[model samples]
Target: MNKLRLLVDSVWRLTWESREAAHCEELFVPFNPWRESDLCMPSLAGYLENAEPGSSFKLNLSPGKYLPQYQTDKKYEFALESFASGTRPPHVGRFYPKYLLMGYFGNPTPFRCIDRQGGKFTADFNHPLAGRFLTLEVMVREIKQKRDEKGGECLDWLDILTSGPGIEARYQGLPTDFFEDDPFHREDEGDDRAFFAQPRLVSHVDTQAQAIMAALYSRLLKPGLAVLDLMSSWQSHLPHGLELGSLVGLGMNAAELQHNPQLTSHLIHDLNTDPDLPFADGQFDAVICNLSVEYLVRPFEVFAEAARVLRPGGLFIHTFSHRWFPPKVVKIWTELHEFERIGLVLEYFLRSGAFGNLKTFSSRGWPRPRADRYYPRMRFADPVYAVWGEKLA
Candidate 1:
């Protein structure tokens, strides 16, 4: 008899107040329906209860159905008496630790700096998704049975979902500081030649994150299509055994791209120095950049160039995580909330004016692989964030 059954559900959300464009987000999570009661949210418990191995469906969730505790409060939207301690100077559209306040100053709750005047900062302590609507799309990836549940903490999917996902949408569609103070500036402005002189041959994200990335790529990619692994490394993160027409890797370190076994061919190039791609227009079916979008100093130019190189309807994708060489990441990347980073990437797609069907995807809460080095330091795998759009025909 079946016991614990595995399932994955995705969430879609969009909100626009003053901004003409809608902020879109898609998030996914895998869970055991039988073991975690709270995770099997009441809205879809019956649907999951009857789900079979390949079941799939979508649900339109009300604003506060899953999580109503996030009631809006006028007090949560005012200016603080003084700039809090143990944090950097406040900036509008940025999130800071809530515990820095006099009351819960010890808590790490997220407090967004919605407005900043000449000498004071207006903070909003409301949950990022406090009043926004959401749509939950579920796909049952697997439904294998296991031993009986021995009993454990009932996980709350909504809490995990809301903890840090909805911040991607801007406040009242107001633009964050994406272009202010030199967004592309980095701490390490040294030569790329010296920074990548050696082949590190390491995975930026952990094994679980790698697995999720491979799975995501597997679904988006198909056989017999030329693909470019831009900003490539030794690990392309493509699914093993997946066949493609041709796979070319373009990166700075020759040694690292050379070691990539899946690449049919590889080239050495530094996109930061030259945003223009060497490939001809409409040469490849797809282009993918992983774990390194934060390093693009000339992202706007590079994204437009990517659009030029793709065939009509070709897709461009970028994936990233929280971890990176701190010195090399763009200045704005470190400033926004984790989810807000998606908004920045989405902006790149929008500004290019060369792509459409824009969307962002993310998945979190998977158990961190115990064998991995960061196992003890983090309880879950590095959350995966992705943004992709197809070249306008």
Candidate 2:
């Protein structure tokens, strides 16, 4: 037999499963309930007391709906009750996939459901397989004599690419305080437009990073397709030979944008102030943000807007280097190690929930013959990192 537990608020739902049948019931425990908790649950101590090291079992559950008392004004209160009750409504039909509720902030919980009218309602919080009568399988791997270390060690760039925690996991690992710092808060928290009004016609990255970026654009971007060069300046750094149907630039400095030879049209907008892109839905084939991602106060929101403007299957690419305006960069960027910056970008893409088929590329190890002569003592060339994702078709 295998034992498992399902916790909702302060209550515990325990199950005992055998080859023949599985039995489950609720065991209310007296304790203060938390508003939100980590998704990973605690292990069952009762089952492990006598279990062998190699013992294992499997658990399977099906999808169903739960109906609970609901009032728009009392959403949180009812949501908590629904979670504790685990009540289900009777509906005779084929089993379907679990219904995802639209309302309620934070991560998705089973306590609430959204109706067609966009009204929030409390729902039964039964496990998806409650009505299907599916068998529960459990497996006991190893019962460690000593507790394992909690929290994972930060990974290097190469290790992150090869063996990933992936985008979603990395996003979840970030602390709430990680994004709350005011490193970019200026004494003159006045208009950002005034700060960027003067055009600085200098490239942020070295020649090697620029070349790598142009090369990447040449390979990934095709000719005669609409493109949005985000946070652009006097030069898009697109490949010299590449042609595009339309190239639109969005930047802060009007003078810089007017000087850009490749851009057919341009708009002066500060992303830090207004993260929303001034474009229709699916307006571009591709969107590229070059060497400027670190400056955004709300990168996840900006990435989401990028996804909204891209056509189905359109690409959004963000390339950055070690170079940045320290005063404008987010606090998290300044605190994290160089390699961990890549993970942070990955999290931005994943947190947006607006793109698919995410990937990362690096030009960290590339040779820089020109840079070597200019800065001989420099241990490495301008390290370029890019993370991209495609809009879901």
Candidate 3:
């Protein structure tokens, strides 16, 4: 299996495995129409309502009531177009029957449609798993007591990293709430192609930050080795003295990539659209993502791809500063503070499970004046952060 699929399956299993089980039972439910208010009941809600406390039941909902059908003479094209354009159609809220049907069936069901005479169309919204026997093993873990609330001191990224798994374990799961839903989850979703069509020669960070990044690259990267500059633009910021056998630039803009003097070759591809990298396994000695980590919607997948493309023991260096297109940045990056941001990146590396010897480094620019200090010697500066790890077998 591919790495991405394997990772997803592993996560799915882990989620179920980690649950606490107290009681379990089997049940078979039939789908039947009731009063308008009763129709809103969830498939499992009816079974749970009558069950005893601290008990769980496995439900096998009947399928005859959730059969797929065709909707003819419907203007589905416009609706689909609006959805693709990151907007909900005006009539979507009014389509209660369709939603009700889908609730009994399933979401993201198989949809087959055909264009017909005139502006009308024929569409099928059938749940892919409909009519199939499903076994749901439910578990009930009762909470008898609540832990006392205590306001412990907030630990920064440095503290968490140094304290080991005790702290880091808290960030292991998927951070779904840390991002926007659907269309917004896709960073740079709309008009991004047009926004990056032309070459805009500009440096994203200050010269000090660039220097720190270049120095890190020089220290970690070797001479005459294949490297990948992911999400690259016109400038790669590689140290002038360092030379690489091959420097491949993968980004969204063709013109900007072509203008990059360091790139031996370049490919135009949006990582958000597809996290899979277009390269043979273990092709690169190192991979670098500079000043663009905030824009990734699926960072874990991209990190896994980086590991796949890197040779065993190869390096993956990701660097970023407090500079980004706000609209394109993910919610997590904008909502969280700098220290938490580092923790988030650390979570990305840990979740990928393809790296070892992880390390983090930060550089602070010009210090703030003494009067601005909230604490003694705690001065504010333009900070640049780098998190790197070695590819593991």
TM-score per model over all chains? 0.81, 0.54, 0.52
RMSD of each: 4.2, 17.7, 18.8
Tens-digit lDDT track of model 2 for 176-221 = 1234445345334557787788889887767776877898789889
| Candidates sorted on lDDT, descending | 1, 2, 3
lDDT per residue for candidate 3 within 106-127, as digits (tens), equals: 3422232333234333343433
What lDDT does model 2 reach? 0.56
Q: Write the per-residue lDDT of candidate 1 for residues 69-106, one digit (tens) a residue.
A: 45446324434455665555566776667766667757
* Number of clashes found in candidate 1: 1
lDDT of model 3 at position 225:
95
Worst 10 residues of 3 by lDDT: 7-16
Alpha-carbon runs more than 4 Å astray in model 2: 1-177, 180-190, 371-374, 377-379
lDDT for model 3 comes to 0.55
Residue 15 in model 1: lDDT: 28
